[model samples]
Every structure is written in structure tokens, then in C-alpha cells.
Target: MLYLWIKAFHIVFIAAWFAGLFYLPRILVNLAEVPPDSVAERARLIGMAQRLLRFATVLAIPALGLGAWLWLGIGIGKGPGNGWLHAKLALVLLVIGYHHGCGVLLRKFVQGLPTHSPRWYRCFNEVSVLLFAAIVVLVVVKPF
Candidate 1:
């Protein structure tokens, strides 16, 4: 029962996290092209993007925690020996790193660190999208 409940929660959170991951980069794609003259609109765009990131984090952390429990606590004691699981963990770590990078950028933005530069943000967006897509593939396909 506990395992089932945890799995449900994990699935819900993972779904939300992946949705944000998929849309964030696309948002950045438009943000990169938005003109500076539209200050209010730009702020709205940035705000929405930041909120999505925050939402993703809130969902992902718990999901990953539950997943860890399902793996290490409920599942077998296997480590990195299983190629599919190993690849999944690697991709998960990459996603976590990407999440942390977003957090760093969030802090910088909050601190008024001149975050309007679309170049760096766009680059980060590209990296985030790639890493997230890779993680999704690893999870779905479990390819070695």
C-alpha cells in the first residue's frame, strides 16, 4: 500500500516536472527574441518562466526522493551494475544538475544581476532541453 501510494505521488510529480522541462526551453526560445522595449511584457515572460522553474523544482525533488525510496528501500539492493538503471541514474543526475543550474540563475535574477541577456539564458535553455530530453529517453527506453 505504501509503495503504491509513493509510486503514485512519484508519477504525478514526475509528470509535472517533465512538463515544465519540456516547455521552459521553448519559452526561452521566445524570450530570446522578445524586444527590450516591451518592458512589461518582457517582465511577464520572465516571471512566467521563473514560476515554471520553481514549480518544476517543487515537483521534481519529491518525485526523485520517492523514486530513491522505491529503488533503494523497496526495490532490490542493486547498484550501478544494471546497465539500464545505471543509465537512468546518470540521466537523473544530469537533470538534477540542470535543476541546480536553474536555481543558480534564479538567484542571480532575483539579485538583479542583469539577467536580461538572452544569449546566456538561451544557451542555458538549450543545455537544459538536451539534458532533459536525454533523461526522458533513458527513463522511457532504458537503453544501455
Candidate 2:
């Protein structure tokens, strides 16, 4: 019962965290396209990015924690058939790196500095989708 509850919350928080991962990059795309002198608009977008990042990070902590508890304590992937889980853990690290990357890009934008072109950000935005898809396939298919 505890395991089911943990899994449910884990799914909920994972969905929420991925939601942020998906959107934050789109915001970066907007940040890149903001007119050079559009001070008010740039500020507003930066502010939104900041808040969203914070919100995502807060959710990520618990999501990660619950995931750890389920795996380590509840033994979701203990013993045999753990290869898929190992791969999934690698992808989870990638997700964390991507989340950190968003913060790095946001910091540069907030500092009134030049950054990548909107096209680059558009390309970058697709990364999270790929990661999400890979993780889902690993979790669901478990083809290891």
C-alpha cells in the first residue's frame, strides 16, 4: 500500500517536473527572440522563467526523493531485471543535467547578456522531449 502511494506521487511529481522541463526551454526561446531594447518585456519573461525554474526545482526534489525511496527502500528494481532501472537512472541524471542547463541559460538571459539564437533554443527545447520519451520507453518497455 505504501509502495502504491509512493508510486502514485512519484508519477504525479515526475509529470509536473517534466512539464517544467518542457516549458522552460520554450521560455528560453522567447527570451532569445525578445527585442534587444524591449526592457519591460524582457524583464517580464525573465521573471516568469525564474519563478518557473524555482517551482520546478522544488517539485523535482520531492519527486527525486520519492523515486529514491521507492527504488532503494521499497525495492522497485531490486534483484534481477534491474538493467532497465540502471538505464532509467542514467536518463534521470540526464534530466537533472538538462534542468541545470535551463538555470544556466536563464542566468545568462537575466544578466542582460547575449545568448544563443532562437533557432538554437528551438533545437534545444526538443531535448527534453527526447529524454522524456526515452525514460518512458525504458520504464514501460523494460526491454533490457
Candidate 3:
């Protein structure tokens, strides 16, 4: 029962973290498209991005903690033959990197140094989707 509860909240936190991952880059896309003279709009977008990033970070902590508990404490996938868990963890790390990359872009936007076009941001935003798809497949199918 305790394992089930931990798994449940782990899923919840992952979902919430992904929500921020999905939306934060979209915010950057919008920020990139904003007219250079639109100071108020840029500020608003920056504020929104900052808050979202911070919230995402908070969500990630519990998600990671619970996931660690599931893996190391309860031993959901700790066996020698459980290569799927390792693959899933690798993909999760990539997604975490992607999350931090969003923060870097957010900072660039705040500094008035955004170098990517909205089209580029659009493409970047899809990375999370690809990672998410692969992660889900690894978890559900466990295809090694």
C-alpha cells in the first residue's frame, strides 16, 4: 500500500512537472515574438516564465524524491536484468536537462538577448513531447 501511494504521487508530480516543461517554452516562443518596443509585454512574459520555472523546480524535487524512493527504497526496478528502468532513467535525465535549458532561454529573454526565433522555439518545444513519448513507452512496454 505504501508503495502504491508513493507511485501515485510520483506520477502526479511527474505530470505536473511535465506541464511546466511543456508550457514554459511556449512562453519563451511568445516572448521571442513580442515586438522589441513592447517593454510591458516583455516584462510580463518574463515574470510568468520566472514563476513557472520556479514552480517547475519545486515540482521536480518531490517527483525525483518519490521516484528515488520507488527505485531505491521499494526496489521497483532494481534488479540486474531491469535494463528498461535504466533506459527510462536516462530519458528522464534528458528531460531534466531540457527543463534547465528552458531556464537558460528564459534568462536570455530576461536579459534582452534572446537569439532564437519563434520558429526555433516551436521546434524546441517539441523535444519534451518526443522525450515524453519515449519515456512512456519504456515504462509501459519495458522493451529492452
Which one wins on TM-score?
Answer: 2
lDDT of 1 by residue, 5-90 (tens): 98889888877887887777556656656775877776877798799888888888898999899889888327554576777787
lDDT of 2 by residue, 94-132 (tens): 999999999999999988777999999999999999999
Misplaced by over 4 Å in model 3 are none
- C-alpha RMSD for every candidate: 3.2, 0.7, 0.9
| Weakest ten-residue segment in model 3 by summed lDDT | 106-115
After superposing candidate 2 on the true structure, give the runs of residues whose Cα lies further than 4 Å from its correct spot. Answer: none
If scored against the real structure, what TM-score would every candidate get?
0.73, 0.98, 0.96
The lDDT for every candidate, in the order shown, is 0.73, 0.95, 0.92
Worst 10 residues of 2 by lDDT: 73-82
Clashes of 3: 0
What tens digits encode model 3's per-residue C-alpha lDDT throughout 58-139?
9999999999999999998876768999999999899889998999999888777747989999999999989988988989
TM-score, candidate number 2: 0.98
- Report the error of model 2 at residue 82, Å: 1.9
